[model samples]
Target: MIPGQRSRPEAEALPPLLRPRRRERPAGRRGGSALVVGLLVAALLLALGAVAYLWVVSDAWRVRAVEGEAQRAQLVSTSEQLQQRVDALQSDLAASDARVEQLAAEKARATDLREARDR
Candidate 1:
């Protein structure tokens, strides 16, 4: 006979303490461990997805930063050009004003000389 295997007559012959009792359920667990493993895999996938998302976001930010810097440089260049043009216009206006004043003074002197000669 195999070890630990017994007919009912032999099992009944053994003292109660030495007898092996029947079990209503199996010893090992399958469902609980499988659920725990499934949860762990899901968590790992979620963490990896988050990392990938952050990497893409960071890349986009870098591109935007570079574009912003280029735009700022272009704006500064435009502002400088506009300021130079304004300064040139101001100088031209001053010269035109000076010429106008000289012509007005000459006209006044001519009128006084004509009136003196007539008197």
Candidate 2:
């Protein structure tokens, strides 16, 4: 009937060494463990997020590198083709110059023959 008395004294029936002991936890200690658990969860989530971000960024970089290589190869091929075209055009220009020189010499000879015939 007392305020602090238990209806059942089952623990008291046991020896003092065998009785269950209960010590009151401070308010701060009880909440401290929960705080630690919450911080650990947050840290876990942060780590996962970092891993996901790195994976995505790395994938993007790989894609960009592959695309860049392809573009470089295409540019190199185009440049080689242009160089071949330039070489061909240069040879044609040289041949045309040689023909012009030959035509000039023949004209000079024809003019000389005409002057001789008139004289």
Candidate 3:
């Protein structure tokens, strides 16, 4: 070492390029944490909206199923009523056929009697 100059440390003797710089805020920006929080809140709101839409869709499905069941029940009842009416009509038709047969026999007997008298 020279007589007038003091000795330097090993770290200081290294090149300035290897040294770290001081931390500083950006020149024209606000706090970055507020922006991140706002984004998180927006994401949360979107998730809530999705959940609500799913709930509504599920409820609608349930309502549709219930309505379908009700319609099926109504159809069954109507079919049963129609079947009863058809059975009653068939019974009435059978009675009418028996009456017509009796009337036809009476008419044939009357015609035979009248032919004998005319001869």
Candidate 4:
């Protein structure tokens, strides 16, 4: 209501705590923080790659171990089969020997009979 004095602006009328803060420098001057963040990201990626490599190597070794066990099992089965076949062959050989002896005796008896008849 005074003739010469003017009222304060709305912003000035607010309490000091409600005013926005002012920066002396622009945000462009703080570009170094971006480089630091990029380096951190690269480090994280490298660590992840190392972990992946270890996992791959461990998996390969495990697969090899499993394959070796399977091969050994197959070999054992083959050995057992061969042993069974050998046992069967041995029994057959014994039977053949008994047949050979019987045939020899029969031949001798026939020879004797023929000689007596001639006399």
By TM-score, rank the candidates, best first: 2, 1, 3, 4
Candidate 4 residue pairs in clash (backbone atoms < 3 Å): none
Q: What would the TM-score be for candidate 4 when compared with the true structure? A: 0.52
Question: What tens-digit string does per-residue lDDT give for candidate 3 at 1-119?
Answer: 88999965566667897655577778535567668889999999999999999999999999999999999999999999999999999999999999899999999999999999999
Highest-scoring model, lDDT: 2
Off by over 4 Å in 1: 1-29
Candidate 3 stretches greater than 4 Å from native: 1-40
| TM-score of each model, paired residue for residue | 0.70, 0.77, 0.61, 0.52
Instruction: Record all residue pairs in model 3 with backbone atoms less than 3 Å apart, i.e. clashing.
Output: none
| Model 4 C-alpha lDDT per residue in residues 1-119, reported as the tens digit of each score | 79899966577768898765676555765667777888999999999999999999999999999999999999999999999999999999889898888888888998999999999
Q: Ten-residue segment with the worst summed lDDT in candidate 1?
A: 23-32
Off by over 4 Å in 2: 1-18, 22-24
- Cα lDDT of candidate 1 equals 0.92
Which should have the higher lDDT, number 2 or number 4? Answer: 2
lDDT, model 1, position 34: 79
lDDT of candidate 1 over 32-101, digit per residue (tens): 6777899999999999999999999999999999999999999999999999999999999999999999
Better of 3 and 4 by TM-score: 3
User: Which numbered prediction scores highest in TM-score against the true structure?
Assistant: 2
